[model samples]
Target: MPELKLLLKHKARTLDEYRRIGGYAAFQKALAMDRQAVIDEIKKSGLRGRGGAGFPTWIKWNGIPKQKTKRHYVLCNADEGEPGTFKDKELMESTPHQVIEGMMIAGWATQADVGYIYIRAEFMDCARAVKSAIDEAYAEGLLGKNIQGTGWDFDLHVHLGAGSYECGEESAMMSSLMGERGMPRLKAPHAPLPTIAGLWDSPTLINNVETFACAPHIIQNGGDWYAAMGASTKNSRGTKIFSVSGHVNKPGNYEIEFGTKLSDLLELAGGIKGGALKACIPGGSSVPILNAESVAKAVIGYEEIGEVGSMVGSGGCIFFNEHTCIVALMWRTAKFYMRESCGKCTPCREGTDWLFQIHDRIIKGGGRPEDINLLKQICAQIDGRSFCGLGDAAAWPIVAALKVFPHEYEYFIQHGKSIVDTPQSKLMFPYAEPVPV
Candidate 1:
């Protein structure tokens, strides 16, 4: 509850209501200042993208090629398809205008002509909510043609994407927006950066929904004001909203300043649901899982989470209690990425399927003696060689889980069953009869 600056109040839905609650003031403040001044304020506030990468927002905007003749674009990535990550969906549903306002400020900063909030097709609620807000903003003279009499014209639209995890990557998002299949492109140094050449070869400022939602706050509160909230850790400033799930009694979004203890947040979510906490996934299903001890010691900041060999990916924390099988969890994780692979890259398209097969076999009491080594080999091939973050994210958790709980994998191999088999997995199993694990 750390005085949420992003989540809107109960009645803060309409343009008038949001304005009453001090909503669009930030965009107005940004409009009054020099365009560069808005970016400068964000740079000064030390605001990093809340989109899991934690990239500095100003740096991304500053990187956009500033050409007067060329049209620039601001793209808001609302395709929140990452497993266990729902903050963006909830944020948009609660306050679509906030995200839109953030986009307006970004448009002004980057001198963009148009913007799109690419929401996932599965998020029908979020899509409808954002679309309604956009229409309302347009009707109220807040978007499209001379917003608030600032003599600046910016148009925003909602582009619904066929929910694809790979599309969550900015480059893939641009491709999908262009009516192309969602897949990643190789980002080489020789090629122009996306900021310079994006969205049909124009400058595009791509940021996540949560990142844009913070723009107004940064502009209104001053960069230093937002920067001073969390621990002064490198790349870890201001507040973040974490979507906590799995084995938590009160699973939901919890907004807190950085450097808050992970254990404290778990407690805020009412601790483990049915049993003692066994492990935690600090970021999302994509990042590495932390042992119970490491979970206890971990803090809320990105850098601190990284120090524990896990990333604060999209700020989605999924905790599991002792009854949960660590290996089974990894199996589920691998299965998800395998099914979601965009099939553009050779490694990810093939390697992810291979991983799922191995996990499936391992959980079914058919694990080979060399399975661990094989998992290591496949993970190495997929981690650094894939075209985008999706492949790397897919392999990260499995690799980390194997390293942290090698015994769990070994137990299934030796005992011919999952270590923590329960009724749910038993009923869901597609393999041989159960045995001691």
Candidate 2:
């Protein structure tokens, strides 16, 4: 494996060690140029948000209002709630300076005076590490006021999220930061385009944790350097952190360039632990599932996966080998979304429970043939129609599982029990785990 350590390496949390590696050089470089020039550089670099949306960073920055405002905020979203997506926590805990430096450069580009790192409550350790790095930057005057004596003052604070997946949505994050419940806001008001109204009526730019971490490298090496690291897809550029889990032997994070084969990523994880490669969840549990043959051909970038009927959402590669029962897997995966559903919209709130019911009936050996079609139709209705991605998120595994393993589902309906004919079902469901009736 060609291990080019840009985001994962570096033990230094202090400004001095970060400086030794040409860290803040980007911030310093950005300070010398006009804001639009910096934005142009990011556009040229082909940098997209690493938090799964893959939106162009330059477009987001440029979307901010240029008119004079009393306050503007640059918020780094550290709420890594996607299942199997721990890459952000790794970057934050291991090489925090990169994230801080990147955010400061972002703040400089956007003319934001204040920045906040809204971290998940579960990631307390990463929060501590990042907060410590922030303190070190402040000591070196890298964070607070008149940065590098350029008369550009930017201050950063770390805020803790109450730990909801919906908070990962940028608008919900803003509302939560304002001491409101962590529910996603409608897009029409649209975060006011991050230029007009953000974080208490100021221009605010909120980016995922890893998105900001990639900035210093782009700034230091020039946009071309970062752009050339991955596939020539319009949006997928630079390295991606794949947090491999499930049946994989080496279930940990693997930092590889974009466009790396899904099979190669699984090999990096030492392949599936015991069973034959049955299925894979290329993104988090949110994106659709890919069968074994398709997994072998799947590439690691955003546009690459889009061609294969799935998305590269959050880079959480979950492997499920032969011994895994699809009905049982769907049951558990649906249960996660049902539990984590913010209960906001009708489709997500009600449909999540409906999915749970269908999967529960199937896994318990009471499925009907028509239930398969029902699952697909229900998921289709939920995928694009819900309030946010969570509806789609809850629907993905169900539809994907049905698409790839229709026969396995059929066998369950025919037998009126698990095809495996094992006693493990009882162990899998200890008690009647209640889903909405």
Candidate 3:
């Protein structure tokens, strides 16, 4: 109902302050209990991956081999590359120890001997904060050989990525970490899941920064206690931190319970600024765009958000005002995906370029009547045919924008201009010359 501050409860800048606020208590409690018991607690908490997938957290933890013949690894996806998403960056900068402790808990649960936080190269501040926290943990005997005298040895390291959005995908990240090009590898059924073989062909468990940050809270309190907070939503438990930006007075991370209404979350961010709310990209740029009507009734849950034709993807909620042009917005989004396409697969490599080219021409007042259907055809070709999710991510928002704002695309194509005539639209495409209808 309100802003639930479980993970962001404090700016735990130092290990001492973090401990004073009961930070590593969960790792300590996990050490005393059976490893299976730790996983069972996570299962009971009903926690899903705070990453875009929303996969159950415990399933990945349990999937690691029980035999432990091979070296096990715990990976924290600190490369927050999704557009409009800054929650992970905040968590790492403010509560670095919480992230480390969560990874330690996962390491213990899965018997992992080593852990690595794959951070983005641009987030030097976050890398330094987490590095400081790791140094503190080692100094206090909380990490390294014989951690806390429990005879369970775990070492953690920080790795900075070279700023590739494709590397945010799990397999690509694995490839990059192993000194290979940051391209995606073949995934499961055809090959092994990351749990079976990852990061130098060993068992690896990976979760994003926000997902791990929740672990300390889930383990410190009982699982049921965490689950009860978001019981109103079907299968979605606990609070999710949303990075609210664009046309909002307070553009920052606001942690809200799962069942909170979309409008309520908007209100929490001080509502829309500049003009009346026109549409919202409820979850990062990759998810579908929601019209004002859909946004009015949307609920903030994994499945509930899906009901309104969008996913709670990485919790990057961007609200746009009436002055914003949907076509122009989508043109910028397509350009991003096109530049970020890794070119390993034909569909994403070619399709993203085509999508951007179409949007670019349409915005520049050279659109054709058949361009809308052509765009749809390209999206269908790319949606499920690519090697990784980047193709789908590239196609989803374009398809959604076409569906939610058909008139915008139709008008832009038919009249060679945006229907929403505003100063913002002119500012968005300053070089465009209007074609006489």
Candidate 4:
């Protein structure tokens, strides 16, 4: 198989071009079949959400009740805000019809009348591309009332978010689409599911961009055919989009069969740039960090990544070669969560700030080993104690980094500088003149 799959050679940015490539064929097939069969096909495809959670797509669509609702909605989460993750943006910008086709089919399955593509504020070009695609779909009668004359009155629109990472959360995205502050809502009775109640109290089916993008293909090909493309694991199967960033020579999105080893991906990415690999954030910044050696055996999927105490979250593999200070990297990561904290819960809001402060001290070369222990304690307290996943997400990397690089951290504390970044008996950063303590 080639390095890239879905978006490669996919020049179907518009409805006409997309149709030429069998764009609406899946949706048409979906309309002709029983809704349950379509859902079953998705299940057999083994497609999971590409937006971090990796939740089974078929199960999520099945969560919607079959009963009639006044209004049902399909929302595409295009908020690609995770640090070092951009697979969705590439898919959306390049293969807009894939998403459109997927959403149309999902709407048909759940009887949704409206669909919205909620893109992040930072993806201005992607937003424009998606909006234009929507326009083209509407113009050619592929969208809007009675799509392809199948009596499926689905209307699609693009709604751009205001740059809040919290909006990446499903409920929060729903809130934002309904004109709220973009903070997550308590998941109880849920966001009034798309089959029963969603936007304006209607049943809503919200799926990530990549998750939807995979749908048309799954529907077009038999589910087993799609599932056979990747790892044998039932937990997380099929191809995934991994965004390699940081010290890699080729840092971009690469679609690989699930369970492809991290080492192979690094090699495919042209290896670490200018230095030996030190550590890697296997998933997005929210996931745990793996030391270089651990990542050596790690694979690019949920199961293998979990074996090494990390996740393939959103498939963002950020490499940090030698000379990259783990303490400094963590401090930078902590600061991102701190600034992005929505302050919805006390633990996340207060704990993130505290974690940032401690990491800040350690990175500046003025903290004790107790600070390391304290950071772990704070992360443990924050996990599973906050209102949303953001709190837990912020702490996973902190704890993972400590577990993998304790010695480096201890060296930093005792010498008042990173082992790689500072030189001296104990008082000088390598990049600057000696400092008197």
Runs off by more than 4 Å, candidate 1: 1-11, 421-437
Backbone collisions counted per model: 1, 3, 0, 8
What is the TM-score of candidate 3? 0.98
Instruction: Write out the backbone clash pairs for model 1.
Output: 45-223
Alpha-carbon runs more than 4 Å astray in model 4: 1-4, 7-9, 189-196, 422-437
* CA lDDT of each prediction against the hidden true structure: 0.85, 0.83, 0.93, 0.82
lDDT of 2 by residue, 1-437 (tens): 66556788676666677778777778878888898888888887888888888888898898777775578899998998888798998888878889888888888888889999999998888889989988988898887777788888889999999778888888788889999998887774543565567688788898888889888888878888888888456468888888899888889888888878889888989988866898888888888888888887887778889878788888888998777777888888888888888888998898988898888888777888899888988898899999888888889888888888888899988897666544533345532765554
After the best TM-score superposition of candidate 4, give how far the Cα of residue 134 lies from its true spot, in angstroms: 0.9
For candidate 3, which ten residues in a row score worst on lDDT?
Answer: 428-437
Q: Give lDDT for model 4.
A: 0.82
lDDT of 3 by residue, 299-380 (tens): 9999999999999999999999998899999988988899999999999999999998899899888999999999999999
Off by over 4 Å in 2: 189-191, 231-234, 421-437
Instruction: List the candidates ranked by lDDT, beginning with the highest.
Output: 3, 1, 2, 4
Return the TM-score for each candidate structure.
0.95, 0.94, 0.98, 0.93
Error of 4 at 96 (Å): 0.6
Candidate 1 lDDT, tens digit per residue, 157-266?
99998778888898889999998888776574967777888899888899999899889888988999888878456668888888999989999888878878899899
Better of 2 and 3 by lDDT: 3
lDDT of 4 by residue, 1-437 (tens): 24747544486777778888888888878988999899999999888888888878898799777887477789898998899899888888888888888998898998888899999988899999999988887888878887777777988888989788898998788889999998887676643544455577778888888899888888988799888876555367778888899888988888878867789888878889867888888778999988888988776667778887888888888988787777777777888899888998999999999998887777676787689879988999999999899999899888888888888789988998777753321222233423221
